[model samples]
Target: MPTESFDERFTGPTLNQDLWVDHYLPQWSEPARSRARYDFTTDGLRLRIDADQMPWRDADGSFRVSNLQTGTFSGAVGTTRGTHRHRLDGLLVETPQVTRRLWTPSSGELEVVVSASADPTCMLAIWLVGFEESGPEDSGELCVTELFGDRIGPLSSTVRVGIKAHHDPRLTDDVRDIELPIDATKPHAYGVRWSGDGVDFTVDGQVIMSSPQQLAYEQQLMIDLFEFPATEQREPRNYPKTAMVHSVAGTSAS
Candidate 1:
């Protein structure tokens, strides 16, 4: 079994800067716009997306996010070098980011107790992605849990999990959504146990999905809350959508 590394309950008056960077991707977008709107509470960490918050990047349509991560790295400004370059044309770094790895793990078991508000216009996710400090091809993602409020029902919810092969030629996208018999608006345990051979995703101690292909590179954690603006068909919802993380724990073989 992997040895326990750290357990965070978020018992604090302020966020622990040593373990977290309270921004989504400040390099792609400016720090002021990418900055996370969150607070440390007695219950844990509360991440929020308020109505007044601007979109992460003006080029991306109608999406707003508040996120925290355990690491960040990017090339110098004016270069198209960063993690999760979603745009096909690529994005230039507005602000350069120095490499920082707080809790990156290569092979491990990681778990979190989390819950999100049931507003249909909002969603929450916890994922791990390659830091890509070594090479751009190292950028792959393992989504531990992704819950869109629209998928949440009273008795069950459809949660997305699996791997995303961004620039990594060694990986192929294998993400899928699975319906589970639990309300996602309430706190529940979500976990992943991984090694070089395979990865197992779990909910409340029960393995729900597994993949034979595993990503061997060290990955950093990302926790986020997202709010989608109302479109012509979708009606607007209230502001301040939130996601609460009760705890996070991890163990590593390294």
Candidate 2:
């Protein structure tokens, strides 16, 4: 087993002042709450969430809650690529704007809404990854999705997402598949409900996909926005990127 240690005393700032870090980050055991400073530690990563700067949402459903500009390098890698030596676990969530606040549910269903803007290229994704092992030949850790991963691009000039299953080329005994939904162009909402049986995925308040093999109970949820400049090929089209979230929560409607 890998030894994991956390720094409870650590507190940092967000990239902005209005967007402060929610110190009581329920994601990690020790460093639950964080400011702007963020780092990866085994099963979890650190991030700052601004409640005041985000959209308003009360129990009455009078206001909508959004996490804009709130950012966090969840999972094993940050915005910048580096050496792939560690195998981190859990879900990651983030936003590109500084006006919305990401909300974490306690025991209800988990929903992710992406409001479309002029930059139709803005893409939002909710991904899940099981594990990463040493790669073959010259490649590094072998990513499972390379075999079964499929893409569901923008649905009606609005969004696109995909799900993939991984079968370790080296170990035939290891195999798992996960499906994810996304929206990039049109304003839409996605959600997932988890229980003992499996996970149910929904889009625009409608159920779309379900997976029996899920890790929602044991991990955390991560939401993120791809904000880097679009590449030459990505200029006209919004090419989506896949992320592996470690944890998932909630109960299925069925």
Candidate 3:
């Protein structure tokens, strides 16, 4: 297979309008809230989770998150299409689903050069979520890389990679945490290649994770950095929680 070159960088002192949208949920109207802000930088896109910021849309004054998607699918979080609960033999079963018209590549490679957050309370994720409103079988997630600052050790950190079956029958939802040679807080390239049969994940072009099942339907790219505030179950820290993205590039067989 040949490489299909696709590059998206944070240029011109701002995010490129043609390549991205601000969010995944439609309820987040204008004058948004939270501490997740996206802007351009000399290195790339700067996604910061400011704990001191206030809420923008919903009154849920909790942690701030910046969720951007390659496609605008459903309006609400997940699928609130209808009250999918009914009584069958005096038992209520709820089916939450929605359909999304998203852009997905059948066989391609996507790479992100990112500097993970250093804040112990913040986290970063690079993954592909299915536009699963089509059916329950369409619900699957391809998590190429996910890391929390607290997981980092003095030498290396564990990078979480895998596939979640969700409601999909085609996947086993197998995932693993692989130790790398460098610090995750520094910039590194995380990539994934899907070729109908399976998926292979790479770090700096070196394979680290793989899956045999395939999801050939519509999907979208979701990369974000966010922080969760302290609660009764969790503690707070002073780590500068933020994600610095240097670039996002893709390739496919041509």
Candidate 4:
């Protein structure tokens, strides 16, 4: 296989007319302090934040450093079905709180958790902060490109998981609307893989979304999640959902 270069497309919240594609993370410089640990044996990640520690702001849309500290939620590891459910902690964005946590940025793995709240707009994502630098204006180099797709629903397209970059702190406006085709309602697993060429989203070890010639850096492993539309409830539906995480060992194909 031919080596793929870095891909840094932007499609979330664009600045001016920029498409705001996904950001690239060099393998050596990923954010490890933000990674979370998943109890694969239990099918969920260990949320460390307490219920009372949740922040007071709304954690929807784009998030910045200043607001990142003000948006989070918490709950105990409640019980459901015949097993223990994952107690949500930290910031809650959108409906079914789709969020990411890097247990060790230094490692090649990341945990992307999804909780399908009761709302219909499902918390498609929680928070995302990627790194990218644009070339001189008009230098014929638009480093970012928009992702294409829709929200998760009967009429929605398959959701694509990835990252983004922000040059400012205020996140009240729509940065951009880069949608991807990610089907989160099937009760299955999805993820993205990157190498020297580009980034790819996969489900059950099957590649789904491929971004060729769109790599921001080499050796960088980014993490992201997706949630479907639900009601106002913060808890996910009792449908035997699974929390899938990629091994950071870099030895196997996820």
Compare the candidates by lDDT and give the number of the best one.
1
The residue pairs found clashing in candidate 1 are: none
Off by over 4 Å in 3: 1-5, 27-36, 52-61, 75-79, 82-103, 232-240, 252-254
Worst 10 residues of 2 by lDDT: 136-145
Arrange candidates by TM-score, descending.
Answer: 1, 3, 2, 4
Model 3 score (lDDT): 0.64
Instruction: Give the Cα error of residue 138 in candidate 3, in Å.
Output: 1.4
- Identify the runs in model 1 with alpha carbons over 4 angstroms from their true place: 1-4, 232-237
The predicted structure with the larger TM-score, 1 or 4, is: 1
What lDDT tens digits, residue by residue, belong to model 3 across residues 1-254? 11235588777575554555555343233324522477677888878665454433334345566755554433343333311111113222122223333334546788999988756767788877665446546657778899887887657888999887766777786989888767887889998988777889999999997778887765567787766666523323543356888888876442
**Residue-wise C-alpha lDDT for candidate 2, range 166-221, written one tens digit per residue:** 33232222223333444333335556555556555666567655555433212223
TM-score of every model? 0.93, 0.35, 0.78, 0.34
C-alpha RMSD in Å of predicted model 2 compared with the true structure: 15.1
Which residue pairs come into collision in candidate 3? Answer: 4-251, 4-252, 32-56, 33-56, 98-133, 99-133
Across 99-127, the per-residue lDDT of candidate 1 in tens digits comes to: 88788788899999999778888889989
- In model 3, where is the ten-residue run with the lowest total lDDT? 82-91
* Per-candidate local distance difference test: 0.85, 0.30, 0.64, 0.26
